[model samples]
Target: MTKPRTILVLGGARSGKSRHAQALAEAMTPEGCFIATAQAWDDEMRDRIARHQADRDERWTTVEAPLALADAIAEHSRSDRVLLVDCLTLWLTNMLLGEADLAAAGDALVAALEDAPCPVVLVSNEVGFGIVPDNALARRFRDAQGTLNQRLARVCDATDLVVAGLPLRLSGEK
Candidate 1:
């Protein structure tokens, strides 16, 4: 069986990366699964999550996998469906906070993507463009995010950098 396309969408905050990823996934298949990596830790975050949920219609199925992202991808992927992973940075944060092995988690995620039978659109923040963080923890997170983005970019069939709500193809076909 042929493996479907995998796209990596990278951008800064509010850069419309999620919207672009969603559009790409929806275009591939009407029946889609939204693998959300965000966890509502506060009222503001809950509101943000609600707004994201509001963007999708009845054709989408929502699954939260803030920590078990690789397992979610492996189990939810199907030959006739598309899977949109909205924000990998959040998943990384969850792993960091939960004291999980970052390298192992990343390896498992890459393996799951390689084994997926359907199209996958992954969203992530381009967090390395700003000034260096003032604290050690912040710096570590930033570095990890950059490394994760680089690794996923290499695995993805297409990588797009979104700026000011516009997408620029960084690799693969346009």
Candidate 2:
């Protein structure tokens, strides 16, 4: 089956969202770029990045776009290749911590997705499953994440929720 132009893959931590995105990209095309939105601010994070890098084979080109995700998508996206954006949640966090305007960034990202010539698969954590946080910052982050996810889902041609490596299509077709 032909993949949709825009796909939003949402899941909890370790719910295999990224893996599912990777599989989607690979299924679309053997040659594609994996746009990672993770910043290695610590040793553990650096190790995690390394492990993720090792997991994907050499057929993929990896690009790290922690802040300028829209620019990265615009630069690397094309009709002949698939673009896998792994985890928008980290990108959102990076934007929030960097004090960037969330609405502006998200708008730009949405524009980019709309204009993208290739299949764009985006991974993000579904933040509404957990209990309400006690801290204000945590709550703020949750709210921002929820808003971003909803906005992206609305723009995406298809939306999937991954749980324990199984994907349930929330919108569009399975």
How well is each residue in 1-174 modelled by candidate 1, as lDDT tens digits? 333399999999999988888888888888999999999999998998999999997889999999999999999989899999988999999999898989898899999999999999999998998899899988989988998999999999999999988999998887
Worst lDDT 10-window in candidate 1: 1-10
lDDT of each: 0.91, 0.89
lDDT of 1: 0.91
TM-score of each: 0.96, 0.95
Taking all chains together, the TM-score of candidate 2 against the true structure is: 0.95
Instruction: For candidate 1, give the lDDT of residue 107.
Output: 93
Among the numbered candidates, top lDDT falls to 1
Error of 1 at 34 (Å): 0.3
User: Whose TM-score is greatest here?
Assistant: 1
